[model samples]
Target chain A: MIKHLAAASLLLTTACLAIGPAAAADPGFTDTEILIGDVEPLTGPPALLGVAASIGHKIAIAEANAAGGINGRKIKYVLEDDGYVTARTIQGVKKVIDVDKVFAMLGISGSGQSIAVMPVLEKSGIPTVIDVAPVKFLWEPARKNVFVVGQSYEEGIVHLVNFLADKNPGRKWGLITQDDDYGITVRDGFDTVVKAKKLNVVYSGNYKKGQQDFSSDMLQLKDAGAEVFLAGGIIGENIAMMKELEKLGIKPVTGIFWPGRIEPVLKLMGPAGDGIYAVDYVEPFAGAAGKAFLEKAKPLVSEAEFKGINRYTMTGYAAAKVLIAAIERCGKQPTWACTISELEKTKNVETGVMAPISFGPGVRFSNQKLQIMQADTATLSFKPVD
Target chain B: MQYLVQLLISGLAIGAIYGLIAMGFAVIYKSTGLVNFAQGEMTMITAYIAWTISTTVSGNVFVVAAGAILAAVLLGLIIERLVMRPMLGEPVFATVMVTIGLAVILRSAINFIWDAYPHGLDIGIGRGIVHLGSIGVRTGQIAVIVTLLLLLTAIWAFFRYSKVGVAMRAVAADDRTALLMGISATRVHALAWAASSVIAGIGGVFFALSYDLSPAMFQLGLKAFPATILGGLDAVLGSGLGGLLIGITENLAGGYLGSGMKEVAGFAMIIVVLMVRPFGIFGERDIERV
Candidate 1:
């Protein structure tokens, strides 16, 4: 009878344990460690873009761990590649959330990829910081668990215009961009500056994405006498436009957004893209902050990667730094709620490479200020000027 | 009027590239009775091969062109032997699926070998601009236009006069009858692939010149598809011309209509044309949809 009673009590104990509450630590949280992961395009056509951004994440995470991590809990980071496709992005995000059970996510990805994974991010309620593309809708609606640490295209354009206008002898600002969302964003930004500053506007032309020839657009812009040009074309389109403009023997004072600051774009632009200006929320590779960043980044990555660092790298680094800082504010016992509260309370935190980041209650876009840098064909790099 | 002239020149130059890809596409469809879905990937990979050859072997146009053409031909033959020959008696859908699989393999291979970075073809062959009156046209554009003209003549001559071309045409018309008449269907099919690949090679190089050479350029092949269907699937010359028409139309639409109409105009024309002619403007009525 005593043996049977012991078996029943043992079964009862097992049942109680099975139905009990989960462990005290949230999903990826532990007393001694916090697990973080990200999704980026590690393969496919956008690999160059994604890989550069991912390196930034690695460098920042490395620096954090080397600095003894957030309040003594070592940070463990995991990365999943999305190959730049929307469906793959969803799959990658889900895999990291379900499989990795990450505490939070800090990665740089394409605008479309970020937008596609929002639903997954929403369902999982994982704290995510979007880097690189900061298209407006992601932050404006203020998804509870998400924050954007990058500047929007609108802000980038605003910076470009405000910076270039003072140097330009002519006030006739013009824009030639894609007809898609990118162009619309550029147009919106241009319109805002034009209205606010009461600047002279000459011509605006929009072309379909993947439109090959730019001769017509250049001719129109030339006819309109647009001396200060804002080119909103993505990589291939930008190079093609520059070539066409060169063919026509006209080089306007041009300004492109963040993408123009990459090494490859600068290389492809060669002579034609010389003297063109670009804007970024992060420090350019030639800027003072950029120099300071190099000192921190040099020890974290290979010499080869250090040389290839561009604007995308800075964005990723900045995002990870901000996320890490917020997690650090959560102190010894970090929960998602506490981490998110700490994130909302984050303000005036200098990320070294970017403008000082700040966030507030109900506010998710952490930074808006940007700096202008001009492409130097001679050095094949971007140099910031006062 | 000068603006119109400029738009026309630009349109024709770009249209010539579309025509180049479309011609290759139409030729494979005509000869094999199987649409080569991997044609765009072929164009992209060969362009990369051309880029490699130009950079490594010689930057001279003649050497690069020769090297690219040779690579394309070999690639075509190998694909035919490995992927096409094994699926001889399969269902047409199965063949299409296989071709798609082949495309994925080729695309992945390109991604693996060349990476996703943009490479410039600064061979100096297509750099200069010519001024005809108030209009300025780039040398690359002229090369594409001239190549298309030459390709049209070559295709016309090959189909009408060349003996091997006649055998290929016999096989395309009726493979069973051609086999009974001492022409080998397999040889013709292989020849068709090789010939089409040569066109893809030439097109790829010029495309890299006309635009930027990148993995994203594989999409150019798909863009040219509307040109193929707008012409006849089997009408090689028609498909080439169709590309030019679409290019010119897109430019005119964008120039006059508020730029948004450019994409719609070309696709709308295709829908209208297909509604009128189900077999494509140049596709044969008697042939199976395959």
Candidate 2:
């Protein structure tokens, strides 16, 4: 009777072992190759930014492959350009999943674009590394697979408020923000900081998304004694404001958010962009570390592509680093289940750009600690604040 | 008082550009009895063309502006021949729809060719700030304002004294009567389109230099819509004055009341004007049509 029972248990164990790996295996992963996917904007209005992010991820993927591959298994990356459209982004991600059969996705930029692909991503059971789009609650529920890689908008704004408090205290403040969800979020973020710190925000004005003239608004802010002006808008609005302000001869101390893109501002503002303050998630091609990373990444990309890297590039690089590390931890033949488990175990993963990433059960997004900088129009360069 | 001075300087600069564009709208409507909704898009496209020429060919601003004007004139004539002429006797709605389509086509074509990035162009003008007591103005701002005044005078003179301009007005008043009087209505319409396009070209260059050129710049049409209604759709002088009034009122409301108050104030003023003076400040009551 004892011999019979032992033989029965051994049969059940064999059945369970056969069913486990078969069920957990995602489509593209095999014994020797792991396929990854990405959706970035390569063309359209924001193409400059999109191209930079795509190149950054491509470099990281190439580097990971060159370094003996991930756990001796090669990593293949397939990218589709979404052109900053939410609908196109959804279709691109679907193609990557259905056609390319990638194991995971990384470096999906744009706020509305990500929201477009969320259902497909969640349904596929493929983990996504958030390289950009710092809207809170994307990873708040600890969805077991999704992870964010940038500082929250609130934290970025908090750093700005903290800096302002230190530089010029007891001064009336004003805000000039665009009218949109992102802009509203920025205003709210700054308002929270101001109210919490008991600072005065004298005047606040909201402009439509594509407004050109700000002379009237600026004049009002000046009359209201707004010594410090905080602009929460895109590069287009910022350029318009600068032009109008110059015409009105009212150059109050100003601070603008990173606008998630830089080339637009640099190209438009040119010489008029002197003495502007901005906060960023990562250093924008500054310092020794930044140059070193560029040197390593330069040969991997085209010369024309080098000018494209900005804050998003760093986020892409960080996402790639985290993905590579997770793939490496999943052993030679990584399955979706094993890779996701490894990703969840990420601790102190070093991204060449941005801050060190350490994500676990409760901490799936990076801390919002940021550095502020001043733009030098003469050099078209950014310098770290003392 | 200082605030008022600042508002005046800024308002006049913006108002000048609007006035020029509004005149273009009135010119086309007065001759053809159809509103060219694509006026703003034409301005944007021509400005971008001028910008491309200025940047790539390193051409003079006058050369670029003149080229843009000639191009717009050709475009306007072609639009009349292809789109407007076919539906000459058709419902006004059809013509309106054609103009809308033209606007969309022009905007999309610009996006496809140039992409969506906004480019800053100098257009051979300086942004040198000039202080007039408490008021401050840039060189480009002053130039734009002066250019508007010059354009208005030239247009008035042409319509008042020039034989061709008088013939065009006769055609606008009664096409059948003008045809009987040995005036070719088609030729008159073509001339009106060409002149309107030239005015649009000027407005385009000034607007682009004053504000960064972008795809969204076409939305300036919405603001101009109120200006057109307030100025009288077919009255050129009224449209120009209406644009100035709207610009100044919107600026003052935005400055003193709140940012949100600007659009509100614009509509309110338009409503009051339409109710009190349905023909507008300078518009003829006999020409009033819903």
Candidate 3:
């Protein structure tokens, strides 16, 4: 009787072991659907980024599902508004992780907001693709689960400064940035290039986040006789500074960070937006890839949502494509660990949205290239500068 | 010298807008003994309303401004009648809290309706710079200063001579006493809010003309708080002067000291003024009986 009981226990143990791996499968994944979460600024000044990212994800997921999805499982996307607030972002991450139980996170907006939710993401070991924010902290000391898709603000700024220094040698430079991580990151890049080139930085000023007036700062830059102004601000600040420069009639050869590449800025700045140089990692929405994206996106999204598509939309689309690519490589019954490993193996993945992206081993930031573009007021769009 | 003149002109232009916003605060506080924390949000909403009208009607600046002012006045009356009137005789803290709540609600509502994108108000200014000898000034800045002066004068005259204005002053002095004197304190309160909204609407339009219009523009209303406190929360005309002083001080400090000093100068001035005269430069000290 004792021998018989021992055999029965062994059989039960084998059964339990067989069920453990299946139970350990990632949350929000099923035979028919894979749920992905996004935390972004859908209701605040940065809402444009969130909205565009959402559309990108929707378009990519819809396209994937139409193409028979990943191993025949459709993608379900969930987005929560963080309003560009860090505290709210943490809450959003929790909701997406604990409540929504998403398979992965994509398009987390803003440097601070993304950084704020890193601890929770690490604890969950969820695969995250940061599409909008370009802070280095997201990928540096790289985690096994975190992957960044775009060039860092530091890299973008450095590239632009190098281009400007080459184009207009020995120009007196001024900088007006927001007093935050985003501004500081750009400033760090600008500082690196300035020190390397031994360039003259005539004026450097910073304004509080969400500040409306730039008259005093502009006047100070004007007084300092800066010939080339480096605008290290987001969309609103960039436009405001340009308007102030126009008001003061100090039209320096201006170089703005990536946020200035948006369409609304050109529209709002009108003729004042002319001649301002901006750097971007993605092809402008008017590019061949962007035109293709618009054509594909038109039928899938509402007219309003389509109109909202911009460079950020491309970011979202590219991020989703990468995520989908990783899942496709995970084979049947893909687990979180398998998906993350597949992501690490990504190489030169083409999305027809931005530049080609690749990630592997210790390298997490997939795209490190940037292109300089000039705003044309007539078209209210950015054109690549030769 | 050119730098100094440039800073001064810029300061006055910004100060004039601050003064107008401050007056809006002063008027509401004087009549109702409640600080409308939503003053900034009101200004932002009015500007957006004007922007929407401008975009839809494709009208010039005057038509947009008129439509915005009308909308603001209507909004003010509705808020008073619907929100403030219901809170009559509530604790001051409770009433103030309500306004704070109102501020949040109004801000969210604006975001929900218009989204949070910045837009430019043409206002026919078009970033024109006028050269006065060696110093240059923006046409928008000059317009802001001129408009503030005219608005302040008109407001002062209304309070000094108009029957409704004198009734409002009486109601502010003592609500119960004004009621005893057959002055409808309710009506005065509603009227005060309407007048304040009109001022905010005009200030918002000009502010948008100078800067881009965004939901964050409501922050300017909060920045004008020091101005209101400096001029006396109850003194409408004095708030305007307080705005000018604060603007000039901060700009001069920023110009000479540095960029960081600009934000500090305004708050520091408020602290010094409060220490010397708790009621403010033009605010009347209240005598309460236990």
TM-score of each: 0.89, 0.85, 0.96
Question: Could you give candidate 2's per-residue lDDT for residues A176-257 as a string of tens digits?
Answer: 8778778878888898888888878888898876667888887777778887778777777788777666666667777888
- Candidate 2 runs further than 4 Å off: A1-52, A58-103, A107-109, A260-272, A292-309, A324-335, B74-105, B108-111, B163-194, B277-290
The CA lDDT of each predicted structure is: 0.82, 0.78, 0.86
Sorting all predicted structures by DockQ, with the top scorer first, yields 3, 1, 2
- Those runs of model 3 whose alpha carbons end farther than 4 Å from true positions after fitting are A1-10, B123-127
Which residue pairs does candidate 3 place in steric collision? none
DockQ of 3: 0.60
**Ranking of models by TM-score:** 3, 1, 2
CAPRI verdict on model 3?
A: medium
By summed lDDT, which 10 consecutive residues of candidate 1 chain B come out lowest? B254-263
Instruction: Using DockQ as the measure, name the better of candidate 1 and candidate 2.
Output: 1
Using Cα atoms, each model's DockQ against the true complex is 0.46, 0.43, 0.60
Model 1 lDDT per residue over B1-290, tens place: 87788778887887888898999888888888898889989998889999998889889988888888999999889888899988887998999899898887888776667666778876877867788876677788899999998999989899999999899888888889999999988888888888888886787788888677877787778778899999889899989888898888877776666456776788988999999997778777884686
Q: lDDT winner between 1 and 3, please give it.
A: 3
lDDT of 3 by residue, B1-290 (tens): 88888888888988988998999999999999989999988988898998888888865877887799899999899999999999999999999999999988887776689866678777575347788886667787788898889878998898899998889999998889989999998899999899888887777888887778876788888878889999999999889888898889888988888776788899999999999989999999999999
Tens-digit lDDT string for candidate 3 (A114-232): 88888988999999888988788888889889999998888889999999999999789998877877778888999999999999999999777766666788889998999999987
